[model samples]
Target chain A: MSSSSAAPGRGDGAEKPPMRDALVAAAFRLFLERGYEQTTVDDVVALAGVGRRSFFRCFPSEDDAVFPDHERCLADMTAFLAAGADDEPVRRVCAAARPVLRMHAENPAFSVRRYRLTESVPGLRAYESSVVRRYERAPAGYLRARFAGPRDGALRADVIAAAVVAAHHNALRSWLRSDGKGDAEAAVDHALGQVRAAFGAGPVAAAGKGPEDVVVVVSRRGAPLWRVVQELETALGRG
Target chain B: MSSSSAAPGRGDGAEKPPMRDALVAAAFRLFLERGYEQTTVDDVVALAGVGRRSFFRCFPSEDDAVFPDHERCLADMTAFLAAGADDEPVRRVCAAARPVLRMHAENPAFSVRRYRLTESVPGLRAYESSVVRRYERAPAGYLRARFAGPRDGALRADVIAAAVVAAHHNALRSWLRSDGKGDAEAAVDHALGQVRAAFGAGPVAAAGKGPEDVVVVVSRRGAPLWRVVQELETALGRG
Candidate 1:
């Protein structure tokens, strides 16, 4: 079928909005029906009733089509962090993650489809990791800038950014694995809350004390009572 | 030049040790001289005095050649964690990271060369992320097993595992960026120490007290005195 005959509303002079949507819809349909690897650019264009040129203009590659607006979401997140207030770095990073979560949550079916596709394909999984690394670097870089002074500031920034991203992924994946039926917002909020508590981003650290005054400690469960008392005494003495 | 003429000692009956070493050396030399993309498996084989079959046997692909022993290293790490005692999960995870760090540190020249190549090539970077993810999952899985009871056990496992891996990467990257010239052992020690401190693996939580009895609050520096006082009062009251 020719482009004009197959898709009546689409023409050479038609605006980008419907054409883009049609292309994405068609591409996803083909990917789901025939598998991501089996589907070709020609197949997508034929199904969408658009020319090859229009397809390329919309998506640089087949993989690009699967994640059409990641770049935009990333840019939005960067902007959100760039405009963040100086004091609440953890809050800013967590907030920066919202757009990404919403991007997945808003399109439950598409996100779930893409998630399954990525899970099955090693190449797509690598591509997805690269995309996730970009999202992680954004927050890490922002936190690195904010945490410029201490010796371990860069390290702290990186690990916390990684934790935030990991939490976001954990929540998003759980929701996706459930076929997107549950309350995603609550899941994400609970996940991010765990991150905040684990990282200790409460009123104390957020108030901006130097590192010398704060000595956080972590131990495994079920220590001897005497050991706990001794450690507590040491910690209290240090404080 | 023919394989026999270029590498006099290599032949069909030759043992695997020298052939593997020769192939790696030849591949690295070519990758450095001509760039990674510009070098091919044929070039590597011809230079190493090996046939195509041998190259494929030793390494699945050119990218795989760049990271020859990651599989072995990952296996070693997994074994290390698997044999760990039940009480010290953090220590076990941190110890598991040492093999990977040692793998890079023991062969500084090759590690640096590969690091530079990965930095220049987007594909290699993605490949590297996949490799790193495997390492991250090892500890995350181990921690998840240990933290099985708590509601947020899985989340804690993943984030802490991410933090451990991030600290390892941060230290490793810093060492690599410095051209492998540094007290890498000390750098890693300090980095992991920060992870241990920030995550709060202390005596109190390890002693099995409920969340209400354990008032582990983190406050910021430069908080209003009254706010700090009020928080302290509230925490004390709760405890």
Candidate 2:
């Protein structure tokens, strides 16, 4: 849960660098030079100029440091969603995803390196997958807040959030595999577009509508003719 | 990969069942009778009437025996999606999800028991999350196939897939948490409906050949006046 916090040690007047981030940097460097299996916490702490106690305070385990602080990201995303304006709930989620996208963009080198390591290492990859899924849930939580019932609400949120995160991974993996050769931002945008498109093209029109005229749908290109007719039928109870 | 063989014993059938199923059943019963932490692999195997080697053969670890056989389910889903008629890609994916739904519904008792243990045990909950995310990937994989591309293919597929799975899990977790008290099928249908609605009420409308022609959206119910007007405007793009 503490991983959702954005900046480590933010409350104090003193601006101490995050021990977690330093350890991660050291670990990544060591992983690249000495290989992931060979590297140890003792080695990382020595390189980061941090004590084992400080390292332990920041992360519960050595492997935990290899990932981003998702707990903080989740909390920040929650706050971003909670603070969203009353209108355009889906858009608000997309906006929240932007920060996460930017976080990767800002640290492309480190991200690419981490991606390489995670890809090559199965244990790290699984751990990374688990961590990323937690981030995916943040947007899901937001969607749940704006939807009707838990069944659809939770699903809708999870789908929306998962899409965004999946897009990021696709882009990140592509970029990493290319050694950062590709347009990462473009990749992120492309991925976010899918999420936006799915939600935009979806039946959410009814979600925000009144009971008197309860059918909700926005006309979009590429939809089949009869399917539209079916929705119309379902909404009106007759074709 | 041997997990996909379906045939119970081919020497490669680690986690394949009758044996696997029995072990899971025994584990759940023991977890209920005692507690998850108190239960061991030996207890589960002994109850299932299998030796220690056989238990390990069916499950990689004690914790894994408790989870839904996602590898088998994922493979089944992938094969189902691959086998779908070209004309009904979405329907095929929907059909694929049915087995997953059925797998849960088939043994509501086991599913319920596993859910209880997972909820109570933090480690089990984490493992449960891992399995859920893996299930989400199947739909994502299907979506990727539906829109495989030189451009916009991956993004479109991944996001749609993510959303679809999110919807599925949302429905599933709700049912699981409720002790199988809720309508599981309805929950799945509602979640799928959200996917349909998100993708648009139906397939995208076809383009008109003539500039002067009015593109009328005839629905089961009459198309909303606003949507009709919008369609008309779209037909005659304001050049």
Worst 10 residues of 1 chain B by lDDT: B4-13
lDDT of 2 by residue, B63-91 (tens): 78776466677787777777764745554
Q: What TM-score would every model get versus the actual structure?
A: 0.78, 0.73
Docking class of 1: acceptable
User: lDDT at B112 for candidate 1?
Assistant: 80
Query: For this target, which candidate reaches the highest DockQ against the unseen true structure?
Result: 1
Query: Candidate 2 — which residues are off by over 4 angstroms?
Result: A1-22, A29-51, A148-155, A201-239, B1-19, B29-51, B200-239
Q: What tens digits encode model 1's per-residue C-alpha lDDT throughout A63-171? A: 7777877877889899999998575787689878988888777667777878897898776787788788898999999999998997778998999899899998888
Query: DockQ of each candidate's interface versus the true one?
Result: 0.26, 0.22
Model 2, residue A88: distance off in Å is 1.4
**lDDT, residue B29, candidate 2:** 73
Model 1 stretches astray by more than 4 angstroms: A1-16, A203-239, B1-16, B200-239
Error of 2 at A133 (Å): 2.4
**TM-scores for chain A, candidates in order?**
0.76, 0.70
